[model samples]
Target: MTQDSRPRSPLAMVLLALLAEEPMHAYRMQRLIKTRRKDDVVNVARSNSVYQAIERLLRDGLIEVREKLAADTGPARIVYALTDDGRAALNRWMDAALATPAREFPEFRAVLAVVAITGPDLVADRLAERAEALAATLDVAEREERTSREWGLPRVLLLEHEHLVAVTRAELTWVRGVVDDLRSGALTWDTEEMLASRPPE
Candidate 1:
């Protein structure tokens, strides 16, 4: 595939990885992702998302249809397997992902950059809500990790879950601290004065 046409998104990488294991139909791939709780890391909420990624992979020559099996009660199932190029691409993507941090622009960070416009009270209230949500998410991830261990899953399989829990807990703590600072007037800002101080072009 040409550089411009290379499939490099998280979904594309995941679809290739799934094919690396064994040739499977699109429906089975989607089922496996959900069953393994990979949906948290990959966006497969829409059924069409998986098929769309498959199409891109096929177009890029990263994967090919191995066979089509007729079903007794539905459309034929087309099983896909990874191409040689795909295996190379998967390894390359993994290496780059693990060895470097890509610059990402998360919405929360963007909002924080200009948050002073929202005034202290509103920002504090919203961040407080976000902290609650983060706490709940962290709790769920911790529970899931414990359950996975109890079920005898290997540590390698739970690495992502562990990372997620750690990140969520850290975010929750930071957000709570910011909210406390705002409420206690430790982080106050004069919106009118700041806006008035802006330099004219």
Candidate 2:
């Protein structure tokens, strides 16, 4: 039973983590995720997805309905709490996620792969713009990291943002170098000519 047939959802893991704190209704769960800035990682924009995740978690027996709350002015809400299984699942999921790097297809990399077709100057210009944007993001991440540290947040809680800053900084460095190479005419490509000259594979 440890490995069910149902597929895992990132949102389900998030719900488990939240319920581990205390039982919460779906609406409160969504609100807390947004307020805590967890929406950055999870797509809380889709309320339907949250509801679907709740249903799946309940079905998996990882979470149990704790109680039903009735309000005089609004609809009744069913609160959910993480089961022991949910806690164990959450820990397992988190450990795996932190230990492994999942293969992800970022849009920027996809665009970068085809940028040579756009020619070097335009690609360089676009890359320069992206570098600026990344630098700005890094600046914000640094400030947030400092604030978190001063607020006595533990390194464990701050590591993800720190990793983001480091990755962005490295990307900026690489991008600047690429832009320089492009502007210096060190990187050149003849798309039409190269295609015409291509041999059958």
Most TM-score-accurate candidate: 1
Q: Whole-model lDDT for model 1 versus the true structure?
A: 0.89
lDDT of 1 by residue, 21-122 (tens): 999999999999999889999999887999999998899888999999999998999999999988988888877777667668999999999887769999
Report lDDT (Cα) of residue 17, candidate 2.
Answer: 87
**Winner by lDDT:** 1
What's the lDDT for all of these models? 0.89, 0.83
Could you tally the backbone clashes for each prediction?
0, 0
Can you write out model 2's per-residue Cα lDDT over 1-201, one digit (the tens) per residue? 234322276688888889989999999999988887778778878668899999988997899999999988878899999999988888887776666665579998899776645667778888899999999999998998899999998898776688888998999999999989888889878767766766799
In model 1, where do residues sit more than 4 Å from their true spots? 1-7
TM-score of each: 0.93, 0.86
